[model samples]
Target: MKQNPTPAPIKINGSNIDLGEALPRKIQDELAHVAETYFGHLNHATVGFTRDGNWYCCTINVQVSNLKVIIAESSATDCHKAFDQSLAKVGRQLLRRKQRVADSRRVQMSAAALA
Candidate 1:
């Protein structure tokens, strides 16, 4: 069994709002897990939150590898909900990228086998 590498530290920034205890540890853990599970390592991650009127906006930018960068944003009535939405979006993007890479490799292997 191989162990996944530690993920990069996450940087959080807030605008027009006081984050104070709002960024949940569970969400950070989930983000780290996603990075490790998808790419085994994370080069960098930045999460920014903004408040506009009654809505909260969350943006997450994650660099999983030299060739991959995932960015997602969402807006909701609460910061936590916005963050969760952004996380989910980023997870889907990462999964799709992984699937695409796997599919390309599989195709290449099959082509080579036929040659």
Candidate 2:
């Protein structure tokens, strides 16, 4: 069995925000798995948490490729919830990208077969 490489630490930027320490380990593991399973390689990831009057906002930026960047954000009552939501949003985007590539390949194959 082969072991997976560890993911890079997420960078958090904002004053008066300590969400980085509060980030759930499960979410971090899920993000690492997403990188390996979807992107095939780990890229840089940045997570930012901010607080408004009554809400918390989380923003995540993932660099999938040299020209492709995935950004996801969410606002919730707390930092952890917002962060989880943002992670899920990013996962959905990655899934969509994978599906698009697979669909394109299938279409090309069918076209070639009919040619």
Candidate 3:
């Protein structure tokens, strides 16, 4: 049986709206899923929601390691939409980071072989 590790605690902050039950749970699950999918481990995460005029803003901060932090923010008319957009951005950022690390290792190995 594959043991499932406990997800890292997520801190949520919002302004001018009741977060309600479903939204928080959804956010927690989605964020944890995304973090695990990209980074394999999540150190910590913080999600913030704010309203600016008609737009709802969502900001997600994910710490995959002690020194590395990824932040993505988006605004939409609905909170859910904002969260989705921000989450997409975070996914892209994490993918890029993972690719960069892979590329660097490949380059080092190739150079070593050449020498």
Candidate 3's error at 75, in angstroms? 0.7
Report the lDDT tens digits of candidate 3 across residue range 11-93: 99988777788789999999888878876778889999999999999999999855388999999999899999999999999
The number of the candidate with the highest TM-score is: 3
Q: How close is candidate 2 to the true structure, as a TM-score?
A: 0.78
Q: Write the per-residue lDDT of candidate 2 for residues 9-113, one digit (tens) a residue.
A: 656665487644546565567677786678676577787777897899888888764538899999999887887899889889998988888899999999999
Off by over 4 Å in 3: 1-4
Candidate order by decreasing TM-score: 3, 1, 2
lDDT of 1 by residue, 1-115 (tens): 5554554788888886777763757567888888778878777898999988999999999998775678999999988899999999988998898899899999999999999
Better TM-score candidate (2, 3): 3
TM-score of each: 0.87, 0.78, 0.89
* lDDT scores of the candidates, listed in order: 0.85, 0.77, 0.88
In model 1, what are the clashing residue pairs, if there are any? none
lDDT, candidate 3, equals: 0.88
Cα error, residue 57 of model 2, in Å, equals 0.5
Off by over 4 Å in 1: 1-6, 22-24
Judge candidate 2 at residue 81 and give its lDDT.
Answer: 83
